[model samples]
Target: MTYNVQIKVMPLKDLLDPQGKAVMSGLQNLGLSGVEDVRVGKHITLRIDAETEEAAKQIADEASKKLLANPVMEFYEIEMIN
Candidate 1:
């Protein structure tokens, strides 16, 4: 079977996100005062061949941990969409 997977990778909450802060500052400078505590993350979508939904999810999780995300500085979430 084929499965669609979605992964979200983000910096750890305790870590400083300079890119996000820079964007937030830019937004504030552009007169968007309501925006606060902005955080930036990556959303990845991919197709995987697996026998079951659970297997697909496991593959996604493994990929996220091993390659897509930096375990020391970032975290990831995986979702399987059939």
Candidate 2:
């Protein structure tokens, strides 16, 4: 089976995000106010070949922990679309 993978990688809640803060400030300057606690993240899309959905998920999870995200400061979610 083949699966389309969608991964969202974001910094852990306790981590500080300077880029997100900057964006929030920019938005306020643009007249969009009252937005607080904005966080920045990354989206990764890929395709994986596997025998089953479970296998695909495992592959994505392993890849995420091993290389895609830093387990200490970041977390990841994997979505498998058939």
Candidate 3:
């Protein structure tokens, strides 16, 4: 079977995201107010062939940990889309 996986990688809460800050600054400059903060992140989609959903999830998790996300500065969440 084939599984569709979505991975979201984001900067850790304790860390400052320069890109996010820059975007927020731009938004404010554009007169977009009331936005307290912004955080930038990456969205990854993967198609994996596996026998079960759990297996696909494991594969996605491993990929996220090994290559997708930087553990020191970022965190990742994986979800099975199908």
Candidate 4:
């Protein structure tokens, strides 16, 4: 069976996101003062062939840990899409 996987990769909370900060600064400069605590992240979607949902999830997790995300500065969450 084929399963759809969604992965979200983001900077660790303790890490500094220069791009996010720059975007926030740009927002403020554009007069959008209500925006605060901006952060940037990546969303990835893929399809995998697996026998079970659990197996699909494991595959997605492994992909995230091994190739999709940077373990040092980023973390990833995987979701199974119906």
Best by lDDT: 3
- Colliding pairs, model 4: none
Question: Mind giving the per-residue lDDT tens digits that candidate 3 earns over 1-82?
Answer: 9999999999999999999999999999999999999999999999999999999999999999899999999999998885
Candidate 1, residues 1-82, lDDT tens digits: the string is 9899999999999999998999999998898888769889999997999898888899899888888999999998888765
Give the residue spans of candidate 1 off by over 4 A: none
| Clash count per candidate | 0, 0, 0, 0
Evaluated against the true structure, the overall lDDT of model 4 is: 0.94
1 against 2, candidate with superior lDDT: 1
Estimate, for each residue in 1-82, the C-alpha lDDT of model 4 and write its tens digit.
9999999999999999998999999999898988879889999998999999999999999999889999999999998888
Q: lDDT: which is higher, 2 or 3? A: 3
lDDT of 1 at 77: 85
- Shift in Å, residue 4, candidate 4: 0.7
Runs in model 4 lying further than 4 Å from the true structure: none
Give candidate 2's error at residue 38 in angstroms.
0.8
Clashing pairs in 2: none
**Cα error of candidate 1 at position 32, Å:** 0.7
| CA lDDT, candidate 3, residue 27 | 100
For each candidate, give its TM-score against the true structure. Answer: 0.94, 0.91, 0.97, 0.95
